[model samples]
Target: MDSLYLLLPVSVLLVLALIGVFAWAVNAGQFDDLDREGWRVLEGGEEAPTATKAQQAGVPLDPGQL
Candidate 1:
């Protein structure tokens, strides 16, 4: 009976804390782009930019050409 008094309030507080966090997240737009993130993972990642002329011509960009 004594443990019940302690445990019940703790459990209720925990539930309320979780609900508060969820409400804050919703208000902060955390879930606004739900679909965009999922689709981004499905699509291929961005490609690297192409190399410059010096790189393609095999010319050393620094002092050492060979």
Candidate 2:
């Protein structure tokens, strides 16, 4: 059918566009820092749980206090 001719070219163009975008991203170092990005999702070792100012000063929690 005539619609097949139009759809074929459109699909090919879309695939080409996606490939071009992927190539551009690769050339721009968008995928270079894989390890750094991966580790960011894990718990960071540097940050430790600490008490707030009120807790540090031995303040009692009121029922309304956040």
Candidate 2, residues 6-41, lDDT tens digits: the string is 999999999999999999999999998879966877
Which segments of model 1 are wrong by more than 4 Å? Answer: 48-66
Provide the lowest-lDDT 10-residue window in model 1: 57-66
Which lDDT values do the candidates have, in the order given?
0.91, 0.92
TM-score of decoy 1: 0.64
Clashing pairs in 1: none
Mind giving the per-residue lDDT tens digits that candidate 1 earns over 1-66? Answer: 999999999999999999999999999999988799889889857996888898999977886654
Candidate 2 lowest-lDDT run of ten: 37-46
TM-scores of all predicted structures:
0.64, 0.61
